[model samples]
Target chain A: MLLILPIIVPMLTAALLLLVRHRGVQRWMAFLGSMTHLGCGIALFRLVQSEGIQVLQSGSWKAPFGIVLVADTLTTLLVIAVGVVGAATTAFGFAGVDPRRESGGYHSLFMVLLMGVSGAFLTGDLFNLYVWFEVMLVASFVLMALHRTKEQVRAAFTYVTLNLLASAILLTALGLLYGQSGTLNMADLSRQWSTAGPPPLHLPLALLFLTAFGIKAALFPWFFWLPASYHTPPAAISAIFAGLLTKVGVYSMIRVFTLLFQRVSPGIYTLILVLSAVTMVVGVTCALTQRDFRRVLSFNLVGHIGYTTLGLGLLSPVALAGSLLYVLHHIVAITNLYLVGGIFLRVRRTTDFASLGSLYRTHPYVALLSLVPIFALAGVPPLSGFIAKIVLVQASFAQGVYWAGGIALFVGLLSVLSMARLWDESFWKDAPDGVDKASPTWKQLLPIGALTLLSLGISVGAEPLLDMTSRVAGDLLEPSAYVRAVLDGDG
Target chain B: MELLFALTAGVLYASGLYLMLRRRLAQLIIGLGLLTNGTNILIFTSGGLTRTNAPVLAADALETTEPFADPVPQALILTAIVIGFGVLAFSLVLAHQVHRSSGTDDVGDRQ
Candidate 1:
């Protein structure tokens, strides 16, 4: 029962939002629903922390037969992050989004998007994950095109087409897996693979999974759709997308690689190591050339995705823990950055760096607030990204993958350069003659402040979070406990 | 019979990929349809083909005898079709809107 509530609450909220026509009421209800979602996520996280992995077989049909919702440490942590980001996005949307767009089922679609994300995080069945991906995809498609501007329509076209292709590829992978293993349950497949060694077709199937999830995660070569579309939506929509969407892909990759593949192919991990290095360098490099605030952030988002995968590539307990920590840090910092981008967009009527300036002179507090996430993203000390990056670098060095560790350090330097450039252009320069320098309303600042504090909380509480992630990483590295819980352990 | 189904699926996949590469929105959407259909058939054939035996069990028997079609792929295909339909409907509407807004169906020229 507790396993399904994170998904169910949003599902119900979306339905209720659709029924109500009043925009104001719908917004309030969505906020309430998201808060409730955050509460449920915390409760679920606590339960899992105290009492091992929690598994609920849907309708009591038994595992390897019925669909299951499993909440291990990794899943619960992401759920809590999703809950936090969702609540912040909704709060920001209230003041950030246009009234007309808000009336166009914004709240409803937002809830559905949350539901889909939660479902993706919680599902234990492969096909069920695909369904949740579709649910999220559909809602995101409508939300991106809600304004229906020409640029938006064009961007949505590219986004939708590419994502649908990824989905088809994912389905093909699922079909092949089921045909090869005679089962779609993740634990069952893992058990079979471990007992008999991987099948002859394992390499192709692994590559297929890599391509499908890699595209979603916005890895090096397949990340074009993300930057092309992410900046086109309202900042609130893009913030949520920035916060949670690609991370879901990383989560799936982690889940599939750690749980199902389990070091069967050293070749795959080496390949991932190479890809992640390129991803990190390429993402930050591209971010440097972008003049649009959100576009710069979008490209950086792609680069940071590489860091999460870096841990998975190493496949050590410390590395996996570092990856999880990176994910948690990235979600808060990136989403807050985009929310600040929204405030900038509202003030300047444009996000282009060339046309916007002097925010520091007019709104020192806003600039100060924005600096936290910006520098945090750059891996400055005493922030969440710093600790996460340090762990990954330490793990890579310990494993003697010196080249990859070197690349990680190199990318961290590039990230600092790019973020500092963004600060210099957007906040410190003289204001263009026609642009507005009016301060954002207090409501707009509230969510940003909350997220900034949350990022700070991650920094201050780094030791405990790192400890939890290491434990989670331990469970990921050894899935016997997870498999047993799913197959035989009580809900 | 299995060979024929596999060939059909391969053909669908080939045509789908070909059409999806075109610049036109209509062809792209049609290509998406073919791609999804190709996936469905691949799933069907991969599950092993059965010409005569349905998945239905006899009234007196506790389990069906050998040579029956696998019900799992059929169920998976059903779910795939429904989801494909929803995505298809959405893409079609979005394409129409893209056309109306841009006054062009060529995606390459839209940017």
Candidate 2:
């Protein structure tokens, strides 16, 4: 019951806050709800570590008949990540969005989006996952369009259309899976998949599922919608979207590929490997040409997602662990950088690198803050990002995938160069004329500060986190434990 | 019967894909509708067809039964139908809003 509360509380709060008329009250309520949710997530993490996996069967119905919210080690970590990021984004939202420009609807829609994201991370049923995805999409649509600027409206249309198409594909896939397997319960599907011989629909079913999640994860060909649409939104929303949303796609990819699909056919893994390499190279090359700070970061995000997919493509335990840890590290680091960029935009009044300069002189603390995560993103030593990349490269080498490892290392070097470009162009040069001298308020600084502190914490605590990630990878690779827990409802 | 359902699904999918590729919003809506119908039929056929019997048990029925239509897929498709309807309605409203705001029905023009 307690395992489910982190998801439930936010949803209830989101619904409750929608009824409140006052903007200030709504903000505070959302902040409080997010904090409580984070607290619960931490508690849930501890509880899972102390006990084992926590399974809460909704409505007390049996596993196949009712929805279940299961919390394993990986889920516990992801829940905490979602909670922390959700809370930070909410606080950042309060500081960044002007309630006068947009109604209190921003806060409300944000809460709803938070609820939907948390729900998607927590649910254990396939159809229920679709429901949560829709919840997230609806909230995201409203949030993306809240300002209703011409650019935003146009961007939102593309975003909505692509996601809706993905959702349609997802539905078709689900229908096909249910038709063949007669169960939408994830645990049951895994069981049925293992024992059942190759059905007539196996290849098509896999392709359908792959295509649906491929769009969300923004892998090679499907990723164009992302860089095009992301830059049109406000900085705060874009930061959160950049940090978390695509990772949800990556999460689904990891979940489905490992737990559901179980084994990637040799040919498919080759294709995936090729896609991962292309995604990495193409994304960075795109970033190299971008002059806008946000656009550059957005393209960089696409490249980083490839590192995660590459780890999975390697199929080594260490590589998979590295991928999971990289997802966690990237989420924190990228969110920090994006939020810091938001502050820069606030001060400089533009995101174009040509139009902005010399932030280190006036806002030394902000500059330093931005520099830490940017270095980490470059895979500089003593940061969690370095440890994650080291593990991935070592894993790939151990598997004799030297080409993949070499490309990954080269990509890491390119990332460093890209971040250096952002630093040299934005913070190191002379200040632009007529720029505002206003400092970031504590409200704006708080979220970035909290996120930066988290990145440093990851740096300091890299060993323990790595150990946990390895254990999670081991469990994921041998998924009988997960299947048993979901099926038998035991720890 | 299975062939009929399969053909219906194929036609719906073909037309749906064509409509979806069109630049106009109305065609997109029509495409989505057709796509969903195709999906529903696919779901129906994937569950193996039965002669005439449904999977419901009556009070006066015997314990033994044969040749019943698979109830599971029907239940699953029912749920899919409701969800599909929700998505359609949402998309319609979304398209309408985009049309109203942009004063254009063509996706290409809006872009």
Candidate 3:
């Protein structure tokens, strides 16, 4: 029951929210549901730590036959991060979203989206993963188009088309893999390939999965859909997408590359590293030219995905740990940044940075709250991003991959420059002529304050989190424990 | 017999991609539908064709024996087809909305 609660809680919440008629009651119920999800996630985190990796085979059909839900350290940590983002974004949406859009089933779709995220993280079956991806895609499609603006309709075309293509590719990969291995269970496939050597179609299958996930993760040359569509939605919706959606793709990539491929291909690693370097360069450079507030963050989100992928490419324990930590830090900081953008949109009625300014002088508290995510995202010292970058660089240098390490450091500098530019234009510059400015209500500031405190908490608790991620990296490197736990427990 | 299925899938995929590459919204939806159907056929062929055996167990038997058709791919295809149908329906509605809103079906013209 505990194993399924993460997905079930949101499912039930969305259903109940849909049934409720009163707007005020619906808002409270959504908040209650998300908080319950957070509680379940924390409980699961505690359970995983005490019990090691937890696997639940649905319907008692055994591991290779039935679907399973596995919550290893990596999955649990991501679940917790999703929980934090979900709760914060839910509150932000309540305050920031227009009443008409909010009434158009926003709360329910948001819960369904969280349910999909949890399902994607926990499922140990490849086909089930595809199903969950569809769930997320459907919910997000409606959420993006809820406002029904001309720009949104245009962006939704690209978003829906490209995402559907990716899903189709993912389905093809699953079908082919099942044909090759005769099983869709991830652990079973990993065990078969690890013990029996690479299957005949292994390379093609791996590349297929890469292509599918690459589009989802917004990797270089495949990321055009993200920046085009991400800025079309409300800030609350964009905040959640910026926080968790692409990370799901990264999570799957890390899971597949580590478990199925076993990190044995030096050529593949080099390819990923080079691709990641190029992605970082391209994303940050594009971000530099963006004038819209959320567009800049959207492009920067793409660049940061490159950093996490770089960690995956390095494949060392330290590097993978860094990758996981980088994902966690990005989730918190980026979501907070978007919430701050939401406040700007709420008060000033626009997210175009050129027409926006003087928040540092006008609302010192908002500026102060904004600085935490800005500096954290910029990899300033003692923050979570800094520690994660240091670990990745240290791992790359230790492995004698100096060029990738150099690019990582160089990209960090570029990210800082882009973020500084954002700061100067949005907060530090003088207010534009004849723009109405209204102070944000307390409800709007509350979630931002909570998320800022959460980011600070991650910084302060970095030591234990790093230690936990290091253990996760160790398990991912030698996945025998994961396989044994899933396969053997069935008997 | 297997070769026929393979050829049909290939044609579906080819035509689907060709149509999808066009700028019109209606063609895009049609292409997506064909593409998913092609994938379904691909899975069915790749799972191996056994015309005489259907993998159904006898009343007294606990499990079916060899030479029986594989049921897993059929199950997978069923799920995929359902999901594909729903998604295609959603896309159709969205494309109609786009056409009505923008007064054009050419996706390229929107930008």
Q: Candidate 2 docking: what grade?
A: acceptable
DockQ, each predicted model = 0.80, 0.46, 0.76
Q: Model 2: residues >4 Å from true position, as ranges? A: A100-104, A432-434, B60-66, B100-103, B109-111
lDDT of 3 by residue, A102-168 (tens): 7899899999999999999999999999999999999999898777778998998899999998998
| Ranking of models by TM-score | 1, 3, 2
> Which window of 10 residues has the lowest lDDT sum in candidate 2 chain B?
B63-72
Q: What tier of docking accuracy does candidate 3 attain?
A: medium
TM-score of 2: 0.94
**CA-only RMSD, every prediction:** 1.2, 2.2, 1.3
Model 3's chain B yields a TM-score of 0.95
Better candidate by lDDT, 1 or 2: 1
Query: If the candidates were sorted by their lDDT against the true structure, best first, what order would they fall in?
Result: 1, 3, 2
